[model samples]
Target: MSRLKLALFALIFLAACRTVPPPAQPHSGFTAEQQAVLRQIGFQPKGDQWEFGIADRFLFATDESRLMAAQKDSLAHTATALVNVGIVSARVEGHTDNTGTARHNEKLSLERAAAVADALAQGGMQRNRLIVRGLGFRFPVESNATPEGRRENRRVVIIVTPEAVA
Candidate 1:
């Protein structure tokens, strides 16, 4: 995409997100340092997991699977912090809105998760410690009837644990 298109896309996404209410900030059992990392890296800390939404912090263009430059930087920071705080593993889950075929959505979601996991690896987390999954659009945080709700539904939710999950 050209610079103008990219800028316009970001502006449009940001404007669209402005009307949506922010999700509640939920803290998990993570140490203070870990919590701080999550916040600083743009995740809304939820107990046992955190939400990295496409709203305000947009990750990709509609149906676009690659990570934006800023997203990579944020994930890198998160990965470093997770390592420092002794988080052994994470299930990096990718999600999408209900606008595409289930199969395509599932594949896109998985690709997005792998992208996130790759970013984490670049930041210091071991690749083997990360598991990626695509839940598709089946598990939405909001209704799919409206634009704002759909925007909120496009997200990456990470579940961190002390031990690796099979």
Candidate 2:
């Protein structure tokens, strides 16, 4: 009986001596500020990406890499939002319609992407955080046969990942 009691006491003591780990912190998808910025910028979550349609004023003219004043202002807001959300990295994809030659389209796309990257950098986003890709006439969201579709295809897409968020 004494041996049994000793064994029980030993087990109890060992259990008591075991260390308890700290509780894990709760994780929300995004910060309030980030959410607010997303809302302000009118971006909707689409699958794994956030999609933002460039307003008419921000739309790039054909074969042009220059940004309008309003476009710059809009990009500045986007940059501020990205900074607020603690995005560590992002890909800026530039796409062009099939109107021009493939080589011309590719060059134009690259130039447009670079222009956006420059604008974002000017808006205070770290240049290192931005990756520029020019898709040319590839990866069209709509059929390039129609004018409207071509217009929709000529766009810049900013891709962000969950791992990118701090």
Q: In terms of TM-score, which candidate is strongest?
A: 2
lDDT, residue 148, candidate 1: 77
Ten residues in sequence with the least summed lDDT for candidate 2: 50-59
Give the distance in Å from residue 75's predicted Cα in candidate 1 to where it truly belongs.
0.6
RMSD of each: 20.7, 6.3
- Expressed as tens digits, the lDDT of each residue in 1-166 for candidate 2 is 9999999999999999999999966543556676566657765555555556454223466777787777778787788777877854567888888888999999988888888878877777888888898889888877988988888778887666555522
**What is the C-alpha lDDT profile of model 1 across 1-166, one tens digit per residue?**
6999999999999998887778877646677877676666566655466655344343445687888888888788878877887765788888889998999989988888899889989999888888899989999888989987777777777667534555
TM of each candidate vs. truth: 0.69, 0.72
For candidate 2, what's the RMSD?
6.3
Task: Pick the lDDT winner.
Answer: 1
Candidate 2 off by > 4 Å: 1-29, 53-58
Clash count for candidate 1 is: 1
lDDT of 1 at 128: 89
